[model samples]
Target chain A: MQIETGELINITDKGNNLFHLIIKADKIADKALPGQFIQVYCSEGESYDPLLPRPFSLFRIEKEKGCLELVFRVVGRGTSWLSKRHTGSSLKLLGPLGRGFTDPREFSRVLIFAGGIGMPPLFSVAEVSKEVDFTLFYGARSQGELIFLERWQQMTDQIFLATDDGSAGQQGNIVELASSLLDSGSADFYYACGPRPMLKAVKRLMAKLKIPGELSLEERMACGVGACLGCVCRTTSGYARVCTEGPVFAAEEVVFNE
Target chain B: MNDPRLIVKVGQFSLKNPVLTASGTFGFAREYNRLFPVSALGGIAAKGLTVQPRAGNPPPRLVETPSGLINAIGLQNPGLTAFLQQELPFLRELGTAVIVNIAGFTIDEFAHLASVLDGETGITALEVNISCPNVKKGGMAFGIHPEAAARVTRTVREATSLPVWVKLSPNVTAITEIAQAVEEAGADAITLINTLPGMAIDIKNRRPVLGNISGGLSGPAVKPVALHHLWQVYKAVKIPIVGMGGISTPEDALEFIMAGATAVAVGTAMFHDPYTPLKIINGLSGYLDVEQVGRVEDLIGIAHKKDGLD
Candidate 1:
């Protein structure tokens, strides 16, 4: 992991609280792995109230010039400040931090579950494997919140889209849709990200089907370097840091909830 | 000599400077070693440890407030065995004093941890973490009462020969009483001002932000509260003090020293800048030279007495 100032290339609004930031950070882009994220300092200098860098998963890693792209939602003061920056602004990024997904070639069949903000790293995985038989299960509240569809369509044809209010594709939650798919032939491997409830549903779905996979967790973090115990996730084997030991873990190992 | 006066002594242990990374803030020295040299710090307090492995709290463990953040990590650490097996060797090699911060629910648990690490070759001191507010059982319960705090301190003090530093909570009504109790209980030093109890709620979802419902607040927001506690405790006890809470810069640290803290601990600021401890250490060096202080100890307790400048 490296900490360096990343030059902002552009910021584009994708709709429904989502924004895409493209930065030219050579060292981080070169080593970024799937499921790893960067702690981006949102404010310039030290005049900000929330004095912590917001964690964002790697959406796109362009290895040629060491440039990377991150997509996030403006939920609070940190992200709200981040959305106002223009090209030529520089911010410090500490990454590519945390454990990420392993090689896809190890598994026979891959099923990807991405919930809203979880789409970025799953997108990175799709970009990595050109020949793997993978199906992307993407979910969001509305079509406006579903980002990078055209880009995903270019990667694979087996993309399943679901929305909460029947606003985009299938009705009900994405995990329920993935649960129904498990009623048929099941994939040997699964990868999941998004909110905890969805991950819990997936944990149940994985247990019912006896499938093993990896999960990328999201947590509010400080010292993206894992020095702070702020981003811990509950596991059967003590607490694991989402910033260090994970952001990615054995889907079966992490205890979702009671 | 162009050297800056930076050595700070406490009990039998002497530090390179008075800038140690506080407990729960500096995770066992390995992670931050990648960003900067861990050898640059005066001391490194490992994460709060428990006898049994702790899974900590559930999702939404942290939230940002005005110039601060609330965290209820629930004392997540690999049990002592794994820490002894995995983390200790690395910490021992960090080229700085290694202080282990231990948390327990009972007096026996506290003594058990102290006894276990008592003669460990690398550990320089034992910082009893009786101030954690996140857990329901043994955390802040002991710190809130002077009697309970003294019992915990006495138990650990008897179990270990190493220097003992008792971390105090600011949520108490009178911190000086607890400080004096620990001092009389054989505590070698004290670390003032753990996170203040804090909570936040989401109006849209009608739910509390932290899964634990409430957490300890740290960062710049709690600096005043920390200084107040340090000031009060300084007048009550003769033991050395390590002042902390929302401390970010050299100026903030200097205030603690002048207010009667022999050393200062840096916590929440490390989240934004992993280089904060080193930055403060360098800044202190420059400050000592510019202020023309003969040594770092020369500035201690200046605010409590008459000074050269008004």
Candidate 2:
């Protein structure tokens, strides 16, 4: 993938310090599938304080408009810098990278487990695929942290949400909700992206239930490509690059904490 | 000539320009070719290889600081045979000088690597990694002792007909002594300084961030230290230096060059910006032309003379 410069087309404040950035870049958006991410250089070429580009999964791709949207919360130097980028600012993107979600048998009964910032890529997947009707489990620490609640409500009939505090939906966690949902054995295959603990829990629960699924993982990456080898995740085979080998892997392949 | 020349000579190797990606940062030179053809670079120092495949350290292999990143990857690689079989073929197609960076646990392993790769075609030189701070064994242990460092250099030097580039560690008290020892041991060139010893703590978890506890710190945070060490080693030894540590921009590369580096390597910067080497390379070309210098070699040791040092 070429590192192309895209002009910031629009920036929408999605409230709760979450933002939806629309950049008019064809190279990444044209090839970008759901779950693949772009490494964004938050500033002009000279800045090194936040020395690495932050990886943002594809939130939405407007193919007709030739623009892709990235959703992120203002958490640190990189995101804060990205937040201030105006419509005319130049943004560099290195992507359409990593393996995107595979349909895997057209997954008629799909279960998506998304937590906090993990909702975007799943959102993109739900937006594109009409092949398999799916249920979405959107969760966050609180209602304020939920990025696109209205959209999730509109997307599918089966949207299960959980918040840590009793601000919204069930007052537990997403992995627990996923486990309870899996107990019924409704989902044919599942997809997930979230905090590691939640994913580990999901993996364990899936293993216990003898279910098969794919997970979209997040790691602190330097190069969005495999060149850096900085972002690594343990697997049954060996170490795999979270950037190149996957931001998506079979749930069975990953070896979580004991 | 009105236009400046960017070619630089390091031992028997003649780099089209003086921009080599530091070992361990650029994996086998294939990954970055997807973003940009690495042919524009002067050279590629392929990832640090061992005698056998290493799985590397556990997860939490990396941490980010203010202007640096500490990675305790533990010299993970597919080993020498795997690299020769799987990696070297594609590396040869890149059409740039490929310098293999080899890490060994013993002087004999080091010599064996050099001896084996010596017969291998398409390798410009070998960067003997005696100063990897991330691994628990055979890494920085050889680098801290000048005698041990010289032993590795001498052993590898005897084994290989190809030029040997000894990579030195910054963790030692006196890097100059080690540089001198390697030079006397028949090293053709030197790459300084490898990452400095560092660690980060997760106060919330009440433990070290990296699985290995500590790793070598690289990036702009280590540039000043790298620059200082480069200057010290430059004054101590007569061999050409492939200076690198935290180099991100053309100006940073120029700093290393002015400090007496024959050429500069871009390491951690590659992590941040994959095309940083190209940026620095183009920037150097622009710099030399703007300054009306005929040769990049003129830029070397300029800072030393500016301080009125002999």
Best by DockQ: 2
Model 1 / residue B225 / CA error / Å: 0.8
Residue-by-residue lDDT tens digits, candidate 2, B1-310:
1122889889776898998999988889877887788888889999998989999988788888888999888888999889889998899889889999999998778988999999999999999998998887798899999999999999999999999999999988899999999999999999999998889998889999888888889999999999999999999999999999999899999999999999999988887778789888888879877888888988887888745434
The CA lDDT of each predicted structure is: 0.87, 0.87
lDDT of 1 at B262: 92
Q: What's the CA error at residue A81 for candidate 2, in Å?
A: 1.7
**Candidate 1 residue runs with Cα over 4 Å from true position:** A107-109, A165-167, A175-187, A202-211, A236-238, B1-4
Q: Residue by residue across A175-250, what tens digits does model 2's lDDT show?
A: 7877766664777788888888888887887778776888888877787788767789989999999998899999
Q: Which 10-residue span in candidate 1 chain A carries the lowest summed lDDT?
A: A179-188
Q: What is the per-residue lDDT of model 1 for residues B178-254, given as tens digits with 9 covering 90 to 100?
A: 99999999999999889999999989989998999999999999999899999999989999999998888889999
Model 1 C-alpha lDDT per residue in residues A1-258, reported as the tens digit of each score: 878899999899988889998999999998988778888887667664768888999888889978889899988998998888888899888889988898787776788999988889888887887688888899999888889988989988988999988888897778889877764256778888898899889888887888888899987787777777778787777677788889899987798666
